[model samples]
Target: MGTKFTFYEFFAGAGMARAGLSDGWECLFANDSDELKQLSYADNWAGEDVDPRDVALVKASDLDGMADMGWASFPCQDLSQAGPKLGMGKAGSDALTRSGALWPFLDIIRDLATEGRHPILLALENVVGLLSSNGGADFHAICSTLSDIGYRFGAIVADASYFVPQSRPRVFIVALRREVPVPGALRGEFPVNPWHSKILLRARASLPDTDAANWVWWDPGAPPAKRLKELHDLLDLSDDADWNSDEQTERFVGMMTNSHLARLAEAQTAGRPMIGSLYFRMRPDSNGKNVQRAEIAFGETLGCLRTPKGGASRPRIITVDGDRVRTRLVTMREAASLMGLEENFNLPPTYHEAFKLIGDGVVPAVVRFLAERLLEPLASHGRAYAEAAAIQKASA
Candidate 1:
């Protein structure tokens, strides 16, 4: 691990990916537009500074030196299912959507190429909705553009639940420069489970043959599954735990449907400590009116964390034991833990502010898994390594 793999992080939300990249990795540059999020990034990373400026105004000359990898988890709002479905802004037009931040990021990468400083590895992370947004036109553009920029790329749909407690499924576009020799062990001839889902396959199939030819079927392999924690274990269930009043909890529980109510009843009589995570969503009633519903999951895996935009929906931790009932907003520290951050990572005091950072960012553990399995090897190994792996793959 003596050799450090240097990276430039764009849309570097509190350096979540940096924390995931772990040891033997060095961040040479980072940037984000939100000053508030930048403050959070500064708090966690001692001595490492962030360029807190709009990506549009950031010129390629602003970047320094060569990097082994350049990662941009550009704004996902425009492409997220929960967000307004605005496509990546027009290529050259000044009109930009929220996710248009990717345009400038690509511009910088293109500029770096003119200076003959192309980062051998490049990755783009975003919501899985990107694959189908605008009737799959957006996905086609993504593949074509990467091919146009001289990259052999592929998409992987990895769920955060594989490594963490939350169920956030994100799309990672992993690419290598067209001239680079790829380790055969890093990819496969066919799409497989855990990374390539049917939706992703359909997207690839829809690609023009020229674009499809540039696609590599990534096989990063399955995660060593962690012991799935019960909600009783992940959260503090003691009587002294931070909790809302019984009245508030009872009122919230009253909003549950009969099916959810039955689960609550089971928790009340489970003869032991039983906790549930609650995510509120608007659902239709018998008459078709969209009524607010308090959906509860008794299992350990919590629902995905959503960005705090417009009105923030704060998730609640609920537990009902015998005659006792309680519910409380999920704390900032808990949110950090669920994102697989170490206890030392800095977080904002308020729940919404902290969620804004954690919700929009990639899970660090997920990133670490990919780095260990593929990215690091690609950055560190050479042509001989690729050839040897190819031989081994063929024999197997």
Candidate 2:
């Protein structure tokens, strides 16, 4: 136990945070509402029983003596672009009321702080849409609430392509207790100053001023030379893998073609649709290597993997061999690979469930990057605070 730190994970879906943090800290307790997720979590990590209860069921009082860090990757339904834009209000019939989940986290933080036994660090994860939720009101409320609880915080948007083959982009927030003095006077500014070059380049073109606001701008001067991973890097690519059949492949092609045609007909030449672009550039290729061996190109990053609806759907693979284009639907293992999981990352027995799990979960490599680079620095600052406090007490 070199420098023991305990963790309490709320909304611990599939335990990605636990996987990342376990290397540096001890996960004392975990909580989530989904039973299937709990089962999956148990299968991967031993020790620490997951309290398989709705977030509301867990009392903040119960966590009084538990841990040193509080981690929450709360449900992002209300804050994600994919969900209906219901910011902390009544959820539509089809929408998940993610706004309701905030209270549990707030309660736990408030309760622990009142007892003077609060965790020194708090971390949160969510979609980028959180920044603009309710015209930024929700973001203001969240930050203000954390500030009121005596925590100084900041956030950064990191893309999975920086570390892994996936293009999954997520926002990670790191907060430190006010009592713990930050290393420099200018705390609450983004910790990682040197961001990925691509982001800096985008910022340079998109933002008004380089230093007008405290926002970290990506510097075009430091362009990354190495190309990001594509569909192939994400795929397991095992010889034994099964691929889709000819009938299924044809059905997908037909459906995509139909969808593309509709968009093309509706759009003007100046306002061409993404579907139209995909269709016009479409090529023919083998369905898959076998029943499961679906291969995509390594030239371009794969599109975001969404929950499969009706019909046989997955990412489309485009092969370029001397201008002769070949296309096929991606496979389950390939889909898993796109989410930044290892080839051997476990999945549920059911294919639908496995797809759902991958879509819902955070990219492990992205989480690990945050843990090591971002969270670890903040936690290290906490250690410095503890050391100074001990010294002051001794002098007194």
Candidate 3:
């Protein structure tokens, strides 16, 4: 495809973001340091021009050309609500923490600006914890950098459940050059609706006046319709034979609490097909000691997929259809569907490897939504915006 638009995918695990931006957009460069992820990425898109170096080692001169858009789904292990909450004190330092990975990505953008090739659009995706990390200082730093570098941006908290069968809520910091044309319809005069939560508003209020003034309450319109496929819709045929055995399924059911057992009993009496996602997690008991608990969704949708913990930490699918009840761990193919990946996109052969790739990706459909609503419309204006940014910077 001739380059009508282009993007650079940073922290590009398996190139899932590239897949979303595939139509009408060409990837100018892609980079990731994880060896296995690099292999999968290369396998999908011929590895000829992909950058395999760590983000810290990459120089701006290494990039192919200025891109219309840039996407960075940085590591969230240090910023997740349930994570270490270590924040960004060590970001950009020699420290080897996953959260610190954000600094290197920013460095690439900052360096590119020195060469007068800053991408017109930028989207950074991570967990909602980014909004509150280190008492909002982490997010403030991100916003400050965007404004300092000649862009106006906004943050949106959108959940994957709105478009897929999984519940994954993430924050996307969408930025555009000051010169790009943003339709009035796309800019909300005030924050509103499913996109802006109370937490996000609080975070925005904490920003310094200079940085906050450049923030836009961007509206990407409505998310796609609620999932067309329910949890059971993606299941393989019951006869395919990968399900857990009778004894194993019995043991898993035994881990359920009385209330959960009652809910199952009600479903059993109703004599209808039902499916639920099951997670084995540790919760504090009445005595304040942590104990393993099996939790299932109240709705038919699956729980959020997460980086797997090897043995017992993955969420499994449990289906009950009248006299027939079956239990099985979610398969690699199903995980792809849950993440809005194309059917049979090249996931790794092993269970954990494939799960990790999908679990830590930006949903293709979600990216497509942002690209179509904003990035695509702004692509043609990228060169114009870049020139204007350069002129303004030079005059300063």
TM-score of each: 0.91, 0.73, 0.91
Error of 1 at 344 (Å): 1.2
Output the lDDT of residue 221, model 3: 86
Which RMSD does model 2 reach against the true structure?
8.6
Evaluate all candidate structures by whole-model CA lDDT and list the values in order: 0.82, 0.60, 0.82
**How large is the C-alpha RMSD of every model relative to the true structure?**
4.5, 8.6, 2.9
Output the better candidate (1/2) by lDDT: 1
- How many clashes in each candidate? 0, 9, 0
Write candidate 2's Cα lDDT for 195-262 as tens digits.
42343234323433322232322111221345355445555434354544557544434544444434
Stronger candidate by TM-score (1 vs 2): 1
Candidate 3's residue-wise lDDT over 1-396, tens digit each?
Answer: 554787888898998888888668777788888988889998788753457788888888888778888889989888986678888664456775687787888888888887877888899999999999889988998899898888899999988888888888999999987767766777899997899998899999999999998999989888776676766677774668498888888887888888778877776777677788777878787799888877665465688888886677776877777766678888888889988888758989999999889878888878888778767766656666556878999999
Quote the RMSD, in angstroms, for model 3: 2.9
Best by lDDT: 1
- Superposed Cα deviation of residue 6, candidate 1 (Å): 1.1
Query: Alpha-carbon error at 221 in model 3, in Å?
Result: 0.9
**Total backbone clashes of candidate 2, pairs 3 or more residues apart or in separate chains:** 9
TM match of model 2 to true structure? 0.73
lDDT of 3 at 12: 89
